[model samples]
Target: MSNGEMEERIIDHLRRNGKDTALKICKALAVSRSVANKHLYDLEKSKRVKKNDGTPPIWDLMETPDDPRPVLKTDTVEKVSEIVRTGGKTGLKAHEIARDHGLTRKTVNKHLHSLMDKGEVLKTDSNQWTSTGHQDSQASGDVTVSDSVLSKCFDIIGKLGKGAYGCVYKAQHKYDGKMYAVKKVKLTGDADAEVKALAKLEHTNIVRYITCWPSSQDWESCQDTSDQSDSSIVFKGSYTETSDYDSPGMESLSISTESESPAKPSQKHRKESVDPSNPSTTYLFIQMEFCERGTLTTWIRNEKKEQRTIIEIDQIFHEIVSGVEYIHSQNLIHRDLKPDNILFGAEGKVKIGDFGLAATLTNPNGAAIYRTKGRGTRSYMSPEQELHSNYGAKTDIFPLGLIWFEMLWELSTVSEKAYLWPDLRIQKCPEGFCVKYPTEHKFIIMMLSPTPHVRPCATTIKENLDRFFSMNHMLCQKTI
Candidate 1:
C-alpha cells in the first residue's frame, strides 16, 4: 500500500475499532511504528486524526466532511459535515457514513451527537444525521466480538451470548484468522482473578486459555454487577512470576497483577466495590478456545427440536466429569456449572468453560469451605451454595447431578420431555429413563444428595461414569 493508502487505512482502522494505540495499529496493519508515526504525523496536520499522549499514545480519527465548512475547516469536521449535508432532508444514517467513509457507525454516531450538542448539526425524526434543520424519523448484529480492544487481536464473527460478567463473542484471530471465543469482562477493574486461575490450567477437557491483552486504555467500559459484602474466597494468589514465560506477547503491554494482601481471600464479595480509580489503565479481556457447536444449552434445546439420536451423550457426560475432576484436582471450584458452561468442542467432545465464577479452594480441614457470597446459577446451585454457607469440593458435585439430569432428560424419549427440570429425585424415574443406566443414575442421585458432605466427589462421579460405560460398552461405542 502507498503512504496515502496507509494513512487511509489508519483512519479506516480507527473508525472501525473505536480507538486503539499506535502499537496495536502497527500490529494489526503489519506496519512499523516509524511508518505508522510518519503517516500519523502527516494526518495530524490535516486535522483528520488526533493522538493522545500517554504510556502508549492513542490515535483517534475525526469525522471529516468533504466540503469543508468555515467552522469545520479541518479535514475531519468538513468530511463529516459533507456526509450529513449530502443526505439533505433524508439525512445520512450513522451506518451510511460507516459504509462510505470506512468509519464505524459508533464513531459516526458519536460525532453526530457532539455536533448536535453544539448546534452544529441535528438528528432528524427519522433518526438520521442531518443539518440541525432537517425534519424527522427513527433508527442496529449480534457480531459476538469486542468493537474495541479485542478487535485489534480478533475480528468478531458473532456473539455467542451474554455471560455473567460480560458478553461472549465468537471471534477470529487477526493474524491466523483462526476462531476463538473472547469474553469481554469488567473484572472489577483488573483481570487478576480469571487470568491467574486460567493461566495455571492446562487440560484437554478444560477450555484452553489463549493469551489475552487488556484494553490498552478504556475505550468502552462494561457495566458490572453491584457489590455485595460477604466473605468467601479461595485462590488468593500465592504464586509469583516465573521465568518459564511464553513469548513477550505485547511490546507496549507491561501487564502485571499485584496484590498487597497476599493473605486476602481468593474470592470476596464486598459491599462497596470501588471503581477502578485509575480506570484508564484497566479493562480485562479474556480469550479462549471457541467451541464450534456452541453451548450445551443450545445443543440440548436443538436435540429437543430434531429428536435426532444423540449417540455421544455418554461420552459427553464422561468428558464433563473429567473436566470437573481436573478442575477439582487443581484446587479450583467451578462455583457455577450448568448446561451453558459446558460447551462442545471439535467432534462430539465436551469442555467446561466460563470460570468467571471459579474460586480457589483453601483446604481448612481436608476440605474447601467456601465462604463465598452465594455462587453458582440458582437452578444448578447446590443446596449449600444456595444457602450461602461454608462448603467444600462436594459443592460442585451437586450441580453435576443437575447437569446429568438435564442431559438424560434431553436424551430420553419424546414423551419424557415434559418434565426436564422436575424434581430429580422423582425425575421421570418411573418411566425408567434414569433406570436405563442404574450406576450412572445412582451416582447422579448421590451427587445431588441433600447433604453436600455425602455428595460424590468428582473423582467418584467419573468412576461411576467409567463403570456405566463399561457395562454398556457395546451399545455406547456404537451409539455416538
Candidate 2:
C-alpha cells in the first residue's frame, strides 16, 4: 500500500479503538517502525489526530467535520467526552492519542489545551486529563456508598483500627472467602484527591483498591427516612445548660459544646474518620489483604519485650528492603517509608501500605513535573527530600537506614547512644545521629549519612543482604 493509504488506515484504527501503541500501529500497517512514526508525525502536523494524555503519549484520531472544508468546533465538552470514553476513565493527552493515530502531535496538543481552557477536560497530576463533569459528578456523591458493589465481595465484620485517613474494618469476601482490611475514607477535605493519587499506583507492596462508591440520592432518601423515625425519641426531653437534653437541636448543641470545650474531643476527631454517605468523595475505600501482625511500629515495640535476637532483626531488615526495592522498581518514591507505613502480613511478609506522599519518578505524559514542598514523615525524610529538591531512588535509602537503626537498638540504647554520635555536619541528617555500619564501637552508628549521594542504593543494599545471608549460612554449616 502507498504511504498515504497506510496513514489513512492508521488514523482509522486509532479512531475506532480510541488509542493505539506504536508497535500496534506498525504491525497493523505493515510498515517499518521508523516509517510508521514518520507518517504519524506528518498526520499530527496536519491536526488529524492527537495523544490521549501526558501519559506515555498513546495516539488517537481527531474527530473530523462532515463539510468539505469544515471549520473546527474545538468544543471542550466534545473533547472531554472523547477523552473520557477513549481514555477509559484514566484520561490521556490529545498529542499522545494523535501519535498513536498517525497524526501530527502538535495539532492534537493544540486542541487538548483548548479543551482544558474550556474546563471540559482537567489536567490531572502532570499531563493526564479527565472529564471535569465526571470529576464533579463523582464529588457530588460524597456520603453514601453503594451496597450493590459492597455486597458482591465482602461484609464488614468489625473495626480493626483508625488513622488519619479513615477507619479500618475487618471484612471477608463472600465468594473468594478471603479476608481483607477495608479502609473507608470519608469524602471531606482532600480525601478524594488522596484516593486519586493512591489509585495511580499498582504494586505488590502497596495496598490494593477494591472500588469506590459515591453517595447517591437513594442513599440520602433512606437516611432521611431513618432519621425521621428516630427524631421523636431523640427530642423527647427538657433542656438544661449543664444537663443532657433530648431535643432535635440538642445534638447540634452538643456538637457545638464539644467543639468549644476545654477537654479534648473524642479520638474520632483526632483520628481520620471515613464519611459513610459519599465513599468516593467523603471517603476512599481501599481493600487489601489483612496483616494480622499489625504495623512495624507495634511489632518492634513488642519484640523489645521478647528481647528479639539479631537474626530476627536481620530478617525484618531484609523484608523491609525487599518491599522498598519493589517500590523503587515501579519508579515510585515512597516518601513516607517508616515503620508506621510498613506492615507484616501472613508469614511475617513485610509490605508497604501507604502511598499518600509517594511521587512517580517520571511524568506519565513525558513532561517534567515538580513538587515544591517536602512530604512524608519528617524524622525519616532524606535531606534532599526534606529540602524538596530533585530526587531519585536514593532519596528512599536514608529512611531505610534510620529504620534499620531503630530495629537494631530498639528502645533501650537508641536515645542515649544516638545522642553520643559525632555530628556529621550534613544538612540531611542535621542531628548527626546517623552512623555507618560495622564500626568498632560497642554502639553501631545509625545509618544517617545526610548526603543522598553517600547513601546506598536499593540494589546495593539488597546485594549486601544476600552476601550477609550467604555468610551466615556458611557459618551455620561450619558450626553444624
Off by over 4 Å in 1: 1-149, 163-165, 216-281, 304-311, 363-370, 411-422, 425-431, 434-437, 475-480
Top model number, lDDT? 1
Off by over 4 Å in 2: 1-135, 139-148, 151-153, 186-282, 365-368, 413-447, 476-480
Model 1, position 381, has a per-residue lDDT of 70
Q: How do the residues 189-242 of candidate 2 rate in per-residue lDDT, one tens digit apiece?
A: 234444564576565555555555543322111124443343211211111211
Local distance difference test scores for all models: 0.59, 0.53
lDDT for 191 (candidate 2): 44
TM-score for predicted model 2 compared with the true structure: 0.52
Superposition TM-score, candidate 1 onto the true structure: 0.52
